[model samples]
Each structure stands twice: as structure tokens, then as C-alpha cells.
Target chain A: MIHALRISLAIIALSLLASCTPTTGTKIAVNQSEISKIKSIGVLVKKDEDFSVRLSREEMSNTGAAFGLIGVGIEAAVRRSSDKDKEEQIKPSLGNFDPQAPLTERLRFHLQEGAIATSEVTDGGEKTAADAILEVTVRQWGLRRCPGPAPEVVQAGFNVNGKLYRASGHATVWEREELYLNGDCRPWSMFRSEELANDILPRALDALATKLVYEILYP
Target chain B: MKRLIRHFIFALALGLVLSACVFSNANVNLAYKPVEGSKSPLSTVKPLKIALVVEDQRPIAERESIGNKRNGYGSVTAQVKSNSDVLTVFSDALKTELGNNGHTVVADKEPLYDVMLRVQLKRYWTDSVIHFWDVELVGTINSDFVLGKRDGDKPILSQPGQGTFRESRQFVTDSAYENVLNGALSEFVRNFSRDPNIIKALQQAGQTATPM
Candidate 1:
């Protein structure tokens, strides 16, 4: 009986470990020659909304209520408190975390790395003196639960949509949407969601910017 | 048999803890000073008071992964920092070199100069990769330069002159990385001052009077 109990526990732990493993998916296309022709590029980011995690208490409560939970209101309240605790723990490290700044910087770095000059351009503002302009729209960002069990494993990811335009004629030269995922099974990830977001989000952005530059320069 | 199993488990836990402590943060400054005693070929071509336009749009801090990854363990990363404005540093370095070589370098809105020298930074970083026995540091600096008259936007030397400098060094310490960067900067100064096209532009600017 003792041997059987130990084997059962080991199997359960192994299964949980497998479920928490992270995975990524991406699709990108570009015209290498046209992108390489651009000598100096200006970057502009659209500020649509603040970044928020997808699997928040509000989203979960809505889903629970849709499924007609027995005590939906109380359950939501509990989840909200739990998430608030996690947020408080992550608040110290997040010193003025402007989601747009990091993404813009990464894009500029990669552009310069490819021997192309870069400058910042305002959206709907005066035209810059660059050969081409890159417009970025951050569609989705934050930490969310990966598809799995009740104690669902969480992952940090973001979706970036970018369009490159010729400065002279404002014609779309190259376009791509990149999705990045970093699903490492961190210890106590649920309780440290904010910390995980702070750590992995920049890495995801770096990976996305690298891919974008590769597609544009090398196709 | 039970004692052996307990000891094995204890050793495995100790190894995991030790592996977790392998990662560390390294702060690196990218600031470099101008190399003294450099000769400029345009020194004898007559002094031309030129407006120096230097624009830097690079990030102040850059983070990158440093170590190679193991099968079950992840790679160690480092956050490289530039405490000072890198653009300003490069600009100042160029200005000092020009001033030392008997040329007037001004950074102002006045249109009193003969021509405008615009230097735009493209890429500046120290990339490190772990080799079999040591780490290799590659320092790179790339910029786009345009020397043109104040009245028109067209470049006098050419459309835009591109200058790139790279230097590599093998080291285990972070300070050696800075030396590599300084070497690249010194190379840039030497190449920019000796370019034949740039000398021709300076000579033309010195011959022509101020535009009305």
C-alpha cells in the first residue's frame, strides 16, 4: 500500500509538470529587398489602451456566471482579492512600466543593428525626414492562464502588429503580426503573475523585434 | 538501501539550489572619451565653421542574454546600461577631435556656419558570446553622416556617407569590453577625418561665402 501511494504521487506530480510546460506559435511574412532599401526609418506606436492581463478576476467571474456557478458573486470576490494580493507583490518592481517605451526601444535597436538609422515619429503628427516609417500597434499584452486544469498554468505573452510605410508616398511596404509566448513553468507563478509579466514581457518583445527585423531585412 | 535513497535526494536538492544561483546582473557603461593626438587630413584645407548636428535615438539601457543554455537549465542574461547619453558622448568626441584639428564646430540654431555636418547614430553596442574556453566581445559603432550647405538639404560630399567601425577582444572581465568599444571609437575618428570626399566638401565650404 505504501509503495502504491508513492507511485501515485509521483505520477500526479509528473502530469502537472507536463501541463505547465510553455509553448509558442508565430506567423510572419515580408519583402526583404524593399525593407533593405530603407536607409533611415522612423518609429511610431499607437496608444489604443492600457495593457491588462487576460485572465483577470473580472474575466473569470464573467465566465463563471455564464456557466451558472452556485455562488458566483462570492467566488468572484475571493478571486479579486487573490489577484489584488499578487498585484501588490509585483508593484514594487514596476517602476513606471510604460509598455510602449520598451517595445519602441527594441524596434529601434533591431533596426540600428541591421545598419539602418532610426528616429521617433509622432502618430498623426508632422512627417519625419526618414526614408521609411514603422507604425506599431500592440494588440494584446500581459499574463494569462494556459489551457489546462483548475490550477491552470499561467504564461506571459504579447501580440504586436506592425506596418512599414514609405515616407515619401506613405505607401505600405511591409506588414506583419508577431505573437510571442514564454511559457516556462515558474514556481508559484500564479501568486507572482506581475513579477513574471515584468520579467518575460520584455524578453517576448525582444524576440518579436528580432523576428520582425529578420523578416524585413532577410525575408 | 533507505539511507542511500535519502542521501541521493539530499544531493539532488543541493544541486538544484546551486544551479539556480548561477545567474547574475552585470551593469556596463557605453561611454567613451575622444582619443588624443589624432591627426586630421583636413587640418591644412582651411578652417570652415560648420554646424554639428548630432541626434541620438538609441535606448539608454539594453538587456541581452549572455550565457549559453543547458538542456534542462536556461541561459543567464545581463542588463547592459549606458548611464550617460551615448549620442552626446559620440558627438562630443567628434567635436573635440575637430576642434583639436583647427576646425570650428558649433552646435546652435544660428545659420552662420559654412555647412552642416549631421551625424546620426545607427547602432552602438558590445555583443558578447560564450566560447569554448572564454567569452568573445564584439564592439560595433555605425553612423550615417551628411555634410551639406546650410541653405539646401542636399549633401555636398554625397547623399549620406556611412561609417562603420568594429573591434573584437576576448576577456573574462567586463572592463575589457569597454576597451574594445574605445578602440572602435578611435577607428571611427581616424576614418572620418581622412575620407577624401569629406576633405573636398570642407575645401569647397571654405572657398564659398555665407549664403544670404
Candidate 2:
């Protein structure tokens, strides 16, 4: 009887652990054979407009929802104040942001950490020369107020679309257009505005940069 | 008895804990925004009685979806579709723009029309391709219009009305999709009506109906 009880408890515990864990989608590591073909890689981000981070209330409304009509105004008020605070924190970073800086910086850092030599492909570098150049065209980017991993919680959402091309021969290597929807389970968030600007938003960008490099290096 | 009670409690707790992972599907609807139609009617001495007929030549009636988002385990979290009759919406937009510009809008078989304009729609699609982090909602409308006698084999004048737009947003909603697509439609109607050639063709058609 004790053994059966123990087994039941163990099964339940395992199931609970698996379900509650924050998910990191399956990883695709770069094959050494793929990386061997290129000696050095450069990152060139193409952007014609200035970078800006906007803090706006989510457009999600409960006016037509089946329930919860009473709490809508209260929720909106709370969200508004939260946005006001979060906007103040993110303002400094939003203004005069160089679109190329983070991706290039993170790419260089990762390359150096892996002992791989990667350079920045500046404007007009495509004509100059390079072994391999990852031309990143930032089509769209912004910050959002969205639901986090759990209910009744809000997170500062950093959204971006990084379109990449292996520009040495100008052949397309990797291109994934980002069509975003809110309420997806994202791993990044912080409650405080200070942490959001100082940590969550930056870390999200860092992860975004890392993913771009990973895909290019692998592809 | 105590062990049974314990088991029951554990099961209840497990159910409560796992239920939080239940993600509701995102249902979406798309429509065109009521664009402030063409401000200035085509420059003409008299208000043209235009009977408009839009002939759809697109490959599909409905547009391709804005795609879907899946969780780590591969269950669908959200999906977006082009939900409405695009032809009807586009027809209404054209009518509004034409009327706003001082033209008397009429049906295809109207006997009082000074000109019969047949719009040949070639391509129209509105979709956002990704569901990951950031997204761009894109809309495109392409059509070539012909003006001549009702049963004429060839058109007197052929001109294309095309509008393509791209908007960046944090997350896309049904209303957001509608707004972007409407923006594209607005541009299309505005450009189509503003063309001086269509007006000139109407004037010239009053005397002559030669094919272009």
C-alpha cells in the first residue's frame, strides 16, 4: 500500500514540475561544418528611421467579452498608471537609440566569447569587402504592455523584426517576418519600471540579438 | 481512509495548477476602416453619372491568414484569418469615394450613367506573416479600371489603381488589421479618383468611344 502511494505521489510531482516550468523552445545549435565555410562574419543593420520605444495601453478590452464588465474601468486605470511609470523609465533608452548598436554589440560579444572573429558591416561595407556579412534590416520594432506567463500580471513586451541576409554574394540566408500577437507565454518580465528599463527590456533585446546571430551562424 | 483523502487533495491541487496553462484561442475579424473618401471629385464641368462594376480576378476570394502562434508544446495559441467578403468591402469603399467626389453612383445596369467603369481586380491580400516577437501588418490592393461602352470588347482607357501599405505594431488585433487594410484601401480609392485621366476619358467618351 505504501509503495503504491509513493508511486502515485511521485507521478503527480513529476507532472506538476513539467507543466509549471518556463519554456525555452527547442534549440538548434550551429553545425561546425557550416561555420567552417566562413572565416569571419560581419553584421550590417539597415534602418532609415530613428529607433523609438512607445509605452501605450494595451488595446485589449472586455466590452464585448462574456464576463467581467464591471472591472474594465478599474483595469484600464491601473494599466494607465503603470504605463505612465514604465514610460518614464524607458524614455532615456528610447530616444536617440542606434538601431544597429545592440545586435552588432551582442553579435561581437558572442563571437568573441566563442573565439570566432566577427566584424561590424557598416554602411557602404557591402561594396568594400567581407568574408560574410549578415545584413539585418529592422523592419519594425516597439515595446508593449502585455500579459505575462501567468494571469493578472503585466510585462513590458519588446517587439522586433530582424530580416537577415548573407550579403557576401547577396544570397538570402535567413528571413523570418515577425507577425506578433499578445498573450503568448514570454519568459521575460519584471514588475518594477526600473527593472524593466534596466533589465527586462535590455535582456529581451540581448536575447533577440543572440537569436539573430544563432540563426545566421547555423543557417 | 486518510490516504484516500490525501490522494484526492493531491489530485485536486494538480488539476488547479495545470489549469492555468489553458490558453484561449484568439478569434479575429478583419474589416476596412471608413476612410475619409476622395475629397475632390475628378475635375469635370458636370457631375458624372458613373455606373461602377468591380470584376474580381484574384486567385482566392479570401486572403491568406496572418498565420498562427504555437506554444513550446505545439498547441495553437492564436490564429488570424481574413474573415469578411473583401469584394463587398472594396465595392463599398469605391462607391463612397466616388460619391464623395460629387459623382452620382449607380448600379452596373443603370441606364442614366454617363460612363461605365469596370474595375478589374488583380490582387488583394492583407496579412501579418509572423507571430513571434514583433510584427508588420501589410496590405496590398491592385486593380486596373476600364472605361468605355457597356458591351464594348475593348476599353477606351485603362489605368491601374494600386495601394500597398506596411504598419508596425506591438501586437495585432482584429481592429488593428482592419485599420491597416483600410489605410491601404483609402490610398487606393484616393489615387483612383484623383487621376485626371479617368475624368478626361469620361469627357472624351461623351463624343468618342474608341478603344485604347
Candidate 3:
């Protein structure tokens, strides 16, 4: 009987630990390039509604001082996991592209380095004196917590859809949609008010921009 | 049961202390002025009398602090907010930069100018994130400029420019995010003035202007 009880307690502890862990989503893929022959590119970043951090029902229910120490430990674990992910997944793929700049600036900076002149195109009506126009639409651009009843994970990333058009004819030459997630898991990791305006979001954005730039320049 | 209570209290105290130590509220102001250019590119040509109009349509230029919101016991995270008049300050900065560039900048609705420069602020914000002991401030601004002869006149040059400035500094007591914003504004103005299209538009407007 005592052995059975011990096993039950061990299982409970393990389950609790699992519930505190963070979870990550899949990495984005680089699509075929369409910007090779284009000498000048006009970038347009469409305005979207503000994005906020979203929490799941599980995160909402798992509250109170009883789980306080465990929550802190879980947060620390999540941070460590995020750092590890950054080192292993993000840095290796992105290489030298910096995440500090906005998507438009980064694109311009990278394209300019490759001898391609870049101009910003605002409002659809303005004349874009470039060979092609790159229209960027940000569907989701913030941090999101995994909606779950199991392992806890938070993702900081963006979902972007891009279309490149030939300016002379205004015809779409290339279209791609990408979702990049940088997340970490911890058991019972229900942090109520974590700041999402951090390096991770920018890094995720940088990753997306890098992938797009790669496809544009090399493809 | 007593031990559980003790642990809970300890955790709560720890969480509160962590939140208190890290969270802050700062009011950022972009107070930098642009230096006048000694050799304006438009020096040889007749200085075009231009109307400078700034439009700021952003809803709010501030990110509010997210205080400790307890989900369950010790799961509290703190967030800092920095608020400022981002649009007004940026317009002032741009005007100073234009005047420094040796352009006659007027703020009138009368159609009495050679060309009109309409600048619209699309986005301006500072994203401040705490990483370990340092706070990273990423300042970004996007503005659209339309240079036309009058309100309904065909635009000579219509372009949008964006600037991103980043700074990571040790979390200090004083407000340093303002410097990052100012740096971004300065870069924006500098880039705008040097844009090949913008320079060309000014020169062309000077050559085509009806003599007063």
C-alpha cells in the first residue's frame, strides 16, 4: 500500500512539473525569391491593429499564492529555455541580420547593402518609382501564451504575409506567408503579467525579415 | 499545513520584491534640436518658399505599465511604461531640421508658396524591454512626405521613410530612453534630407518656381 502511495505522489509531482514547462511552435520556411532582377524596391508596411499578449483558460485558472514559488521557478525555467532556443535555433539561422531595427528598416538596410535602392511606399496611392513594390502585411505581431491544460509555453513572434509586385504593371510576382515562433515550456508556468515588449519579439521579427531578405536576394 | 503557509508567504514576498526592483514608469521626451547645415544643397538655386505641414494621427504615443497581476499565488510579472508627446516633439524636430537645411519653412494655409511639404506621422513608438540588468529601448518612426505645388496640385514627390534606433543600457535611475528617441528623430531627418528623390524635388521646384 505504501509503495502504491509513493508511486502516486511521484506521478503527481511529475505531472505538476510538466504543467509548468513552456512550449514552442514550428520555425518558418523561406519561399522562392522574386527580387533578383529588381534593382529598386519600394517597401510598404500596412498598418494593423495593436496586438496584445493572450492567455489561455488554464493560465487563468492556475492562480494564487499556493503556486507562487513554483511559478517563479517555472518562469526562470522558461527564460533559460528561451535563451537556449535563441542560441540554438535563432542565431544559427539568422546569422548577422540584427533584430533591433523595424522590419522596413531592416529590409532597406539589407537590400541597400546588396546595391539595391529601397524606398518606402506609404498609402497605396503614392507613386512608387521603383521597379517593384514589396507589400508587407502583419497578421499577428506580438507575444502569445499557449492555450493549454498541459505544459505551459509562451511564444513571441509574428505572422507576416508578403507580396512582391512589378511596378510597371502592378502585377504580383511573388507571394509568401510565414509564421515564426520562439517559445519555451515549463510546468505550471502561469505568469499573470509578463512583458511582451522584449528582445524575443524583435528577434522573432528579425528572423522573419532575414528569411524574406534571403529569398529576395539569393532566390 | 503550517509549512505550506510559510512557503506561500515566502514566495509572495519574493515575488513582490522582484516586481518592485524591476518595474519602473518613465516619461520620455524627444528634446533634441537639429543643427543647421552650413552648405545647403539648395544654395546655388533660388530658395523655394515651402509650406511645412505636419500631421500626427497616431492614437497614443505611450505604453502603459503592466503592474503585478497575480494569476495564481507567486506568478506575477512587472512591466514598465514610458509615455510622451511623440508626434509633437517629432514635428518640431523635423521643422528645425528643414530650417537648418536652408529652406524657407512657413506654416500657413494660404496657397502662396512655391511648393508644399506635407509630412504625416504614421507610426512612432518606443519598445522598452528588460533583459537581465539592462533595458533595451527600440525607437521606431515612420513618416510620409508629399511635395506638391498646392493642396490639389499634382505631387512632385511622394515618399515614406522609416527610422529605427536601438539602445541597450544598464538599468539606471535616470531616464535614458529619451536619448534613443531623439537619436531616431535625428536619423529620420538626416535621411529625409539626403534622399535622392527629395533633393531632386527641391532642385526641380526651385528651377520651375514662378518668380515672385
Best by DockQ: 3
Error of 2 at A128 (Å): 40
lDDT of each residue in A1-219, candidate 2, tens digit only: 999999999977765454311111112333445556656667676654432323334442332122233344455566567656654555555444454677578767765654557777677467634456655555544454332123334333333444433445555444543222122223223332354445554565565565455444433
Q: Candidate 2: misplaced stretches above 4 Å?
A: A1-219, B1-38, B41-45, B61-84, B129-133, B206-212
In candidate 1, stretches whose alpha carbon ends up further than 4 angstroms from where it belongs are A1-219, B1-23, B31-35, B57-76, B130-134, B159-171, B209-212
What does candidate 3's lDDT look like per residue over B62-144, in tens digits?
32421122222333334334354555677777666666655677775766788898887766655443333333455556667
Q: Which pairs, if any, clash in model 1?
A: none
Quote the lDDT for B76 in model 2: 43
Please tell me how candidate 1 rates in CAPRI terms: incorrect
**TM-scores for all candidates?**
0.40, 0.39, 0.42
Instruction: After the best TM-score superposition of candidate 2, give how far the Cα of residue B120 lies from its true spot, in angstroms.
Output: 2.2
Interface root mean square deviation of every model, in Å?
20.6, 19.2, 14.6
Q: Rounded to one decimal, what is candidate 3's iRMSD?
A: 14.6
Off by over 4 Å in 3: A1-219, B1-24, B36-45, B60-85, B129-135, B172-174
TM-scores of chain A across the candidates, in order, are: 0.64, 0.52, 0.55
